[model samples]
Target chain A: MSPDRPTLTATPHNVGVDAAVAAARRVVTALLHAGDGSAAAMAEVASRLTAVAEHLEEHAPTRDERLVDMWAGEGVTRHDPVTGPENAVAPPLPLSGLPDGSIQGTVTLGLPYQGPPGCVHGGVSALLLDHTLGVANHWAGDSGMTGTLTLRYHRPTPLFEELTVRARQVSVEGRKIRTTGEILAGDAVCVSAEGLFVNKHLPRPR
Target chain B: MSPDRPTLTATPHNVGVDAAVAAARRVVTALLHAGDGSAAAMAEVASRLTAVAEHLEEHAPTRDERLVDMWAGEGVTRHDPVTGPENAVAPPLPLSGLPDGSIQGTVTLGLPYQGPPGCVHGGVSALLLDHTLGVANHWAGDSGMTGTLTLRYHRPTPLFEELTVRARQVSVEGRKIRTTGEILAGDAVCVSAEGLFVNKHLPRPR
Candidate 1:
C-alpha cells in the first residue's frame, strides 16, 4: 500500500468526522489563497487554519499510535515528498510521562528550501531553530513567545539530510526562559543558537 | 537636472575606474540572478555590494564630508529600485559633540516592501530594526556584531510612512550592549525591539 493510503484502526466509526474535517481544511486553504493577502485578511486566514487543524486533530485517529505504527510500516519507511517525507517518518512524542527540560525532533529540508546550491537558507534555519526552541521552552514548563534569538552558523546545512534538533532549558528568571539548541548533521554541529523566550498570558480562546 | 541623473562629481581624474566598477556590479547582479539563491551566495553578494559602496565612497569627492553632514547633497539621493525606493535618499548622520547616547536618522519606506498587502514584510522590519540598532550600538561606542535581537510587533507597520525609529541604551555589561527601539507610525508604536550587541576585536584597515 502507498504511504498516502490511510489505514483505519480497529476503533469505532469516525470516518464521517474525519472526512468533514478534511473538507473543511480544503475549504479554508482555498479561502486563504483567495484573500487579498492583507494583514487583516491573513489574520483571518490564520485563525481559520488554526480552527481546521484543531478539528482535524480531534477527529483523526490517535496521532501517537498511528505515527508509531506508520514508522514501523514498510510503506512509510522512506520520507514523503510533500508534508515532508522525513517529518512523516518522525517518531511521535510519548505524552505518558513527559520530561522536564528537553525536546527532540527530526526534519528533512526539501527543494522548497533551496537557498544556496544545495544548502538551506539562513532565515529558514532561524525559523526551525526558533520553533524547536519554543517547543523546548513549552516542554520545560515555561510556555512563552520568543523574545530574542541568537544564532551562530558553523557551516552550511545540506538539504535532504535528516537534521536532529534538540533544545534544553538553561534557566528561567522572571518571565524569561533561557534556552540553547544545536542542529546536528549526523554527528557534526551545523548551527548553534541561544534564545530568550518570554512568558506572556495567552489570550483566552474566543 | 533630474534627481536620477548621474552628474559628474568634480570630474574624477579616472572616470574609467567608476565605469569599470559599474560594469562589475552589473555582471555580479546577473550572476546572482543565475545562481541557486543560498545564504552563502547572499553573503557573497552582500560583500560585493559593500565593496562597490566603499569604492564609490572612496572616489566621491564629498563622501567624508557628507558622512558628518546632516543634510547630504543630491548626489546620494537616487533610490535603488532593486532594494526598493525606501532605501533611496538615506540622510547623513549628524554627529554633534554631545554625549555618547544619541540615535538619529530618517528613512523612507516605499511600495517595494509590500509583503502583506499594504504592510511591510516581517523580515524587512527585522532588517530595518537590525540596521538601526547596529548604528545605535556604534554611536554608543560599542561597535559589534548582533548577538541577539528580539522584536515584538504590537501592530502592523504600514508602508509609505515616515516611520521614526529611536534606540536607547538600557544597560551595558562588559562587552555586551543592550538597547531597545520602537518604530513609530505617527504617534503609535507599530513595532518594538530589544537587542544584545557584542563587541569582538577585529583588525581594522589602515
Candidate 2:
C-alpha cells in the first residue's frame, strides 16, 4: 500500500479556496494549545474531534486504491498543513517570486509548532528550509527530490512571530542541486541549512 | 507575551492515561489522510470536527495564563493534533528508558508526514532526532534544551514503516550535551543526526 493514504488530490485553488483552508488551520492551531483545566472539558473536546473524524470517514472516498505523493505544489511549511488545501495544511507560506532567482517567505508559527517553551520546533525550522531550498532548486530549473539536508540551528526560533527565510541555489552537479538558506527574526539568524536535492528520473510516458 | 501559547500546566500521567492518549492518536492518523471525495463530505467532516473544537473551546479553561512543554508525557501528536494530550501532536514517537540507560523508540509516518514522494518529511526526521537526542541527554544526566541540531539525510526515510531510533550522549561540556542518533528501517540508515543540547539556566526561585 502507498504510504500516502488516499487524499482528494485536488489542484491548489484560488484565494477563496485558500481562505477556507486558512480558517481550518486557525482552529487546528487553537486546539494545539487548548490546555485542559477540567476532565469534562477534555472529554467533550475529544468527542467533538472524534465526531468530526467519523464524519470524514463516512464521506471519505471508499476506495480500494490510493493516490500517492501529491506534495503540495505550493507547500510552504508554517503556512500550510499537509492536511490543508490541496492536501496542504492551511496558512501556507505565501512565498513570492524574486527577480534575482531566489525565494523569500514570511510566517508566524504558533503553539502547534513549538519545541522549546517559546521557540518554534527545530524540525519545523528545517521544514521551511527544505521547502524553500526545493523551491530554490525549481527556480534554478533543477527541481528534484531532497537527497540530503544539513541544518544548523544557531538560536531558538521564536513562535507567534514573523520569521523571514531566503534561499538560493548554490551549484549543480549532474542530478544534484546544492542550495543554502537561513531563517531570521528581525536581525537574529536563528537557523541555517544547506540541502542536496537530486532530480528524480521521470518515467517517460508512452 | 511568550510565543509559546499560554497552556494549562499539567504533569504526565501513567500507563492507563497513556493508553487513552495513544487511542486518540490513532484517530488523528486516520483523519490526517481522510480523503474528502465531495464538498458535502468536506462540510460534514468540517462540522463534526468543529463540534469537537466547539466542545473544547466552551469547556476549555479560561484563565490568567501558564506555559508548559509536555513533550508527549501524554502527547499523541497524530490524534490530538498536538494539543489534546500534554501538548503533543498525535502519532508521536514515544521514547522511554532501557536498563542500559539509553533510549529507543519506534514510529510510522502516514500521509501527513510525507516529503519527497514516498519518504518522511525531512524536518520530521530532524524533529525525532532532536527529541531522541534530548531524551538521550536526559538519560545521561545532562538534559537540556537544544542548542544546535545538525542532521544529514543519508537517504529518503520511508513512511508507514516501523523505524527504530536510538540515541546516546557522546560527550558533555559544562552545560552542553553532545548527542548522536539514527532513524532506521530494519538495517538501512535513512537519516543520521547529531545535536548539542544546552542546559537552560533556570531562574532561581525567589
Candidate 3:
C-alpha cells in the first residue's frame, strides 16, 4: 500500500489562473485592436506580457514550500486564447530552450501597470531590466541575485503595446555577472539597462 | 573701462543652480518631515523622498547640464535622491553630527506610501535599502550609481511609525563599493540589504 500521500494543493488560489489568463488576454487583445505597431507600442506589449508572467509565477507550484523556483521546470510554453491578438505577441520561451549563453523574451503591457497617466512606472521598468538581466546571467551559467541595475529611459515607455527585451552577457568575474539589455517597443529602444548580478553561492538543488 | 558683462537669459529655464538648490531644499525638508524615527516609518518616508527626488531630477536639471564645469566648481554635490526602498533608503537624520561611514536617519509613515491598506509597499522597503546603502557608499567615498541592490524582507515593514535605518560601509574596490545595512524597529531587523555600487568615473573638470 502506498504511504499516505501528501495532499496536493491546486494552483490558482489567488484570482484563479483562468481569471489571470483572461485579464492578460483582454490587455493583449486591446493592443492588437489599436494596431499602431510602433516601437513604443511594442514596449507596452512587453510590459503586459511581464504582468502575465508575474501572474503565472504567483499561481504556479512552489518548490520546497519555502521558495518558488521562478526559473525552474516550466509547465506552459505558450497560451493563445481566443481573445488574444490574431497575431498575438507570443509568450517568451522558457530559458530551458535557449542556448547556454543567450536570453530573450517578449511581453505586452496594459493599464494595470501604469504609473504615470499613460506611461509605465519607472520602478516597473527597473523590474523588467532586473529580471531580464538576471536571466542573462543565468543563461551565461552564473546564477545570482541582482546586485545593481542602472536604467536610462531615453523615452517614456507607452502603455498597451508589445515590446521586446533581449539580454546578453557581457562578462563574468568570480561571483559577479555583468550584462546589458534594452526594451524595444519595435525597432525603437525606449529603455536601456546594464547591471551587475552577484552569485550568492547558494547550494543548487540536486 | 568697464568689463563687458554677460547678459543673463530670463526665459524661466528649469535647469539652473538656484533651481537645484530649491529642489534640494524641498527634498531635504520632505525627507525630514516624513520620518518618524522608526524603521517601519523609514519605509514610508523613503517613498516620499523618492517622489521628491524624482521630481527634482525631472524638473531641476538634466544629467548633462549637471555635469557642466561651472557647477562642478561651485563645490556642490549633485547627489541623486533616493529612488526607491529596493535599492536605497534615506531615513531622516536627526542629529547633525555623525561619524563618517555611518548610516543615520529616522522616518514616519502615512497613507500615501501604503501598499496593502495599513502596510508599507514591499517596493518601498526595497527603496529604503537602496538609499541607505547609497548613503553608506557615499560615506565610504565610493559614491556611484547603485549597480545592484538586494533586499530580503523577512517581515512586512509596517506603516506609520518612527523607524531607523543604520548602515555602514563594509569594503571597497577600485570602482566597486560594498556595503551592508538594516532597517530596524527598536531591536528587530525588519529588512537587511547588501549592495554593490559602481563608481562614476567622471572626467576631471577642466
Per-model TM-score versus the true fold: 0.37, 0.77, 0.37
Q: Given the true complex, what DockQ would model 3 score? A: 0.03
lDDT (CA) for every model shown? 0.44, 0.58, 0.44
Query: Is model 1 an incorrect, acceptable, medium or high docking prediction?
Result: incorrect
Can you list each candidate's DockQ?
Answer: 0.03, 0.28, 0.03
Tens digits of per-residue lDDT, candidate 3, B1-206, equal 11232111111123332232223233222222222221223333233333333333333333233224222443212222232111111122221114453755666643323332244444445555655665566555677655555655455566667767667878787887877777777677776777766776334323
What digit string (tens of lDDT, one per residue) describes model 2 on residues B1-73? 1233211122235332333343344334444445433333454444554455555455444322324323324
lDDT score, candidate 3, position A59: 37
lDDT of 2 at A136: 73
Distance from true location, Cα of B118 in model 1, Å: 16
Can you write out model 3's per-residue Cα lDDT over A55-138, one digit (the tens) per residue?
A: 333433332321123112433211111011110111221222144455555666653233333455444555556556655665
TM-score of the second chain of model 2 compared to its true counterpart: 0.74
Across A17-74, the per-residue lDDT of candidate 2 in tens digits comes to: 2332333444455455455433335544555545554554564443222333232334
Tens digit per residue, CA lDDT, model 1, B74-128:
3321111111111111111121112436564334454323223345444345555
i-RMS for every candidate: 21.2, 5.0, 18.5
Best by DockQ: 2
User: How many pairs of residues collide in each model?
Assistant: 5, 24, 54
